[model samples]
Target: MKVSCSVVVFALVFHFFLVTGSRSPPPSDSVIIIGAGMSGIMAAKTLEEAGYKDYIILEADSRIGGRVHKGQVDGNTVEMGANWLFSGGPKSSPAHEIAKKIKLRTLYSDYGNLSSNIYKQGGGLYEKHVVESAFKVADARQEFGTNLSKILSSKKGGDDDISILGSQRLFKQVPKGPLDLAVDYFYNDFEEAEPTRISSLKNTFPRQLMEDFGEDSYFVADPRGFETVVHYIANQFLSHNNNKITDPRLQLKKTVRKINQSKNKVIITTEDGSVYHANYVIVTVSVGVLQSDLIGFVPRLPHLENELPGENMIFVTVTDEESRRIEQQSEKKTKAEIMQQPFGRIYFAGEHTNSTYLGYVDGAYFSGTFRSPSDSLYPLLGRAT
Candidate 1:
C-alpha cells in the first residue's frame, strides 16, 4: 500500500481554491471535519497550517480526543483508552513526538519481565527454568508459524487461510497442561484478544507492534492525562483558555445524524437539529459508526465491508471475530469489503482506514496527517490545471 501524509490533501485543496478563484457557493463554501479525535484534530491542524481557515469540527462527544480518553479514579487521572505511546521504530510516530514535545510523563512497559514474574495456578511463582523452558518452546512455535506464513503467502493461487491453531497443531506445540495453557494464553489470547482457533496464522504470526513500531512501549503516566497530547495539537490551531479549547470552530456535543451531499456542496445535520453546509467534509468516525445506521447518508456510501482491558480490574476484550460479528452480521472477509475510498464530497480518515497500522494510534495520526492522492479525495478538490 502507498504511504503518504494528510498534509498533501489540504495543501492541494488550498491550491485548488486559489487557482480556481471561484466565490460562487457564497462564502460558506467551507470544510467540515467531523469528530474531534486524533485524526480529526490533526486534519484540522493540517488545514490551518495550509492557510485554510474556513472550516469547522463537529464532535459528537462533549470533549475532544475521541477514543483517547481518561477517567477520574480516586481523585487521580487514569487513561481509559490508548495509553501506550509506541516510539521505538526508525520512523517516529507523531503521537510519540507530541508526547516528547509536551514532556508528558511515561513509564516503559517491561514486558520482558513477564517471564520472570510468571506464577502457577496456586499463585506460587513457577520454577525459573520451567518458565524459561516454556518461553523458549513458545518462541520456537512462533518462529515456525512465521516461517510457515511466509511460505503460504509466497505460494501462487493457494489458500493462505491457515489458523494459528492449525499452525500450533502442525508444529506439535498445542498447549495441554495447565502450565502450558497459561503460557499459551499469555502468548496468544492476551495479545490478539482472540484464541488461536479463529485468528489467521498469517495475520497473527508477525507481531505488528514490534515489526511496525519496534519493541518499546511506554505507558503514559501523566497527571494531565494521555489526552493532553491531543489538546496540545488542538491548541496549535484552535483558540483555548485555561487549558480548554474555546475555539468556536470546534462544535462539541453535536452528534451528526445525517449527511446530505450535492454536486457542489455537502450538508450535515446534527442530532440537535442543526444543519451545516460545507464544500468538503472529512469524516473521522470509526468503521463501526459507519456500518451502523446512526448516521444516514442521502446517497448510500460505497459498500466496502468492514479492545481491552484487563487488569486485576477485570476488563474484557471481546474477540476480534466476535466484535466484527456484532458490528456486521455477515461473516464475510472483512478486510476486502472495507473500501477506504471517499464518497462524493466526504473524505474518510481514521486508524481503521489506515492499512499499514490499522487499530493503532500511530495509524490514526498518520491517516489524519497524510494520505496518498490515489486513496484520498485530493483529485476531487479540482486540482486539474
Candidate 2:
C-alpha cells in the first residue's frame, strides 16, 4: 500500500511545533494528549513548541513515561520499556537529535562481539560458528523478497485480494533450511511481534531504513536510569515557558470511561464522573488498552478496518544482583535492539522489545509511537455496547 503523505506532513508539523514551541492555545480549540509515554510527551512537546498552550495530557497510570518505565533495583536502575538509540548519526534519526538536544548521554552498542551464548533446548550448549552463515542467507532472502515486491507492484492488476505470503511466493523464491530460519530470526529481531502476520513488502521498508540510516547504539547515563531523560525533557519545556512542570494537566487515577466527539468539540467522561472537553484529543494509550475496549468511543473508528489485533508487548526486567553483574560485564555486547515485526496500528516500542539489552536503562528510551487515521475527536458520540 502507498504511504500517506498527509500523515508525514502532520508528523513533520507536529515535530516542528514541539521543537520551536511556537503554538499557542486556540481560543476555541484545546488539545488533550492521552498517555505520558515517549510518543505522548513528544506530541505534547511538539504542540508546546508550536505555541499551542491549551492542551492537557491524560495518563491512566499515576506516573508519566507510559512504556518507558524505569526504577531502581539493587542499586542499579532498570528500564521497563523503550531503550536504545538505534543510531546517533548527526542527521537522520530523530531520537539521536533529541538525545543530544536534551543533553542525554549515549553509548555505541557492540553487535560485532560475537560472544553470545547459544541457548538450545535439546542439543545442549555448543559453540555455534558465529551464525554468520545464517545471517548471510537471511540477507539474500530479504533482498530477493524486496525485489519481488517491486516486481509485483509493477505488474498489471492481477488479484487485489491475494495474501501477502501468496504475493511473496508468486514473486520471490523462498530460502531453504538454515537460511530460512536465519531470515526468520533477523525479521523477528526487527519486528518484535510476529513474522507470519507481517507483509513482506511492508517489513522491508523499515529494515532498509534501519540498515541505511540507523545505528545499533544505546546510551548509559551517569546515573543509569531512563527517568532522567524524561525529567530532563519535562524540565526543559517548563523552564522555557516558565511554567510549573508539576501542574496536574493530566488527570491521573481518573480512568476515561467514554469519549464523545463532534465536528466542533470533543468530550471525555471519566469513570469518576468527571468530564473533560477539547477540540483535539490525542489517544496515546497502548494498543492493548484500546483493544480491551476499556475506553468507549461514540461514533467508532473506521481506520481500524483491516488492522491487526493487538499483539501485547511485554516488558520483563531481571534486576537481581547477579543479573546486574552479568549485565555490566556484557555491557559492550548487550545493547537495546528492536524486533522488527509489524502488527498494524499496534506498534511495539520498549526496551525489552530488543533482546541484547532487554532491561537496560537505554531500552526505555527506544520505544516509538503510532497514529491511526480516525484518531481525531469525532468518534466519541454514541453509547457503549
Candidate 3:
C-alpha cells in the first residue's frame, strides 16, 4: 500500500497491448503491471479508478485468473478456464457490472453440459432426434454464414470474415454422419478448443459474436467460485479478508523474465534476479504466451499480429506444440519480421487485443477496462496532496 510518490507504474497488464501504438503517461506513477490476469486486474482496477494507486501486479500463476481459471470438479467450484458470460442481463458490461455488484450466481449454459443423453463413438444410445437434426445443420450453417456476412458487408466484404472452414468450402458440404459428427463435436470439440478449421464462424461464434449479450448463454452458478468476480474486484483496494489475499500489490509468483525498456525507465527482470523498476510497461501476455518465448525483451519486442486462417493451426489456431515448432521454423510470419510499431512506454491488454469484444469474458473486460489517469497527472495531484 505505498506507491504515490509522484508515480511509478510499469503495468504490463497481461493479455497486453498495441505493440507499438503510442499512448504516453509514463515518466512516473511507476506502473509495472504484467498479468495478474483479466487484463492485469482490469489494468490495476483502472489505475485505482484514475487517482493512480502506483501499481504493481506481475503474476505468473500460483493463481490469479489469467484465463479466468478455477478447478475442482465433482465437489463443484468449476470453470477451468475463462467460462461463459455472454448475453448476460442488464447489458452485461464489466461482467454485468460485477454480476450486479456481487449477487453473482448464474445459469443458462448450452452445449458443454449437453444433455439428452447422447453417447456413441463406441458406446451406443445416440438419437435425441438425431442430435436435434445435427443441431439443425449446425444452425443452418451459422445462419447461412450470417446472411453471407451481411451480404458481404453490404458489398465491401469485411466483418464476420468467413472461416468455419470457409463455410465448409462455401457450402459444398462436410459433416454428414454419426449425427453430423456430433454436430462437429459441439461446434468444434466442445465450443472451440479448436478445429472448425481455425474457428470464427460468425465472429468468435454464436454467443460471443457480441451485440451486447444477445443469444443468451450464462454459466457461473457461483457456488462461491467463478472467482466471485475476482474476489469482488480484489476487495476494492486489495487487502482482502474471508477470501484471504494479503496484497503486496498482488505479487503472486512474479515470474516475468526480462523486459528492459529505457530512454527514461522500464527495467523489469524477475526469474528470481528481482529488479522491478517502472515508468509504464503493461504486457498482459497470451497470444499463446507471446508465441511461447515466455518473456524476454531487452529491445527485441514487437509481437501481436496473428489474424489466423489455417494450414493446420494449433494453440487453437496454428495447432499448438509451440505452433508445431512455429510451423517447423517458418512458412513465414512471426509478424512478418517483427516490429509493427506500437510502443510508447509499452501497453497492451487482452481478448486478443480486442476489436469489438474479440474473445470475450466480455472481451477480457474490454481489455482490462482500457484505463484513464492522465488529465496531465491532475496538475501534479493538485500540487502534491
Per-model RMSD to reference: 9.3, 15.2, 18.2
Q: What are the TM-scores, per candidate, against the unseen true structure?
A: 0.76, 0.63, 0.33
Alpha-carbon deviation at 240 in model 3, angstroms: 3.3
TM-score, model 3 to reference: 0.33
**Runs of candidate 2 exceeding 4 Å displacement:** 1-28, 88-90, 101-107, 115-130, 150-183, 186-191, 197-200, 204-212, 219-224, 239-244, 305-385
| Candidate that scores best on TM-score | 1
Off by over 4 Å in 1: 1-29, 151-163, 198-205, 304-340, 371-385
Candidate 3 per-residue lDDT over residues 1-385, each given as its tens digit: 0000101112223222222112245323667878876667776776665556577888877877777767888898877766666663445567656876787788776654353667887887676777776777777876676676556545532322556778766876677677677677666546556566655564444443445556466677676766667667777767877777788888888889888887777899888788988878778776666655678777765322232332313212455586776655533233221221346567766665553455555555556665312122223333332
Q: What is the lDDT of residue 201 in candidate 3?
A: 61
Off by over 4 Å in 3: 1-29, 32-37, 42-162, 174-218, 223-229, 232-237, 241-278, 283-331, 336-344, 353-385
User: What digit string (tens of lDDT, one per residue) describes model 1 on residues 131-185?
Assistant: 8898899889889998998798666545355878899999997878887888888
Per-residue lDDT of candidate 2, residues 82-195 (tens digit): 555556333345445566666666666676643244444455543456455555555565566556656654555321223234544654645445435445554443344334
Q: Best candidate per lDDT, number?
A: 1
Each model's lDDT: 0.71, 0.48, 0.60
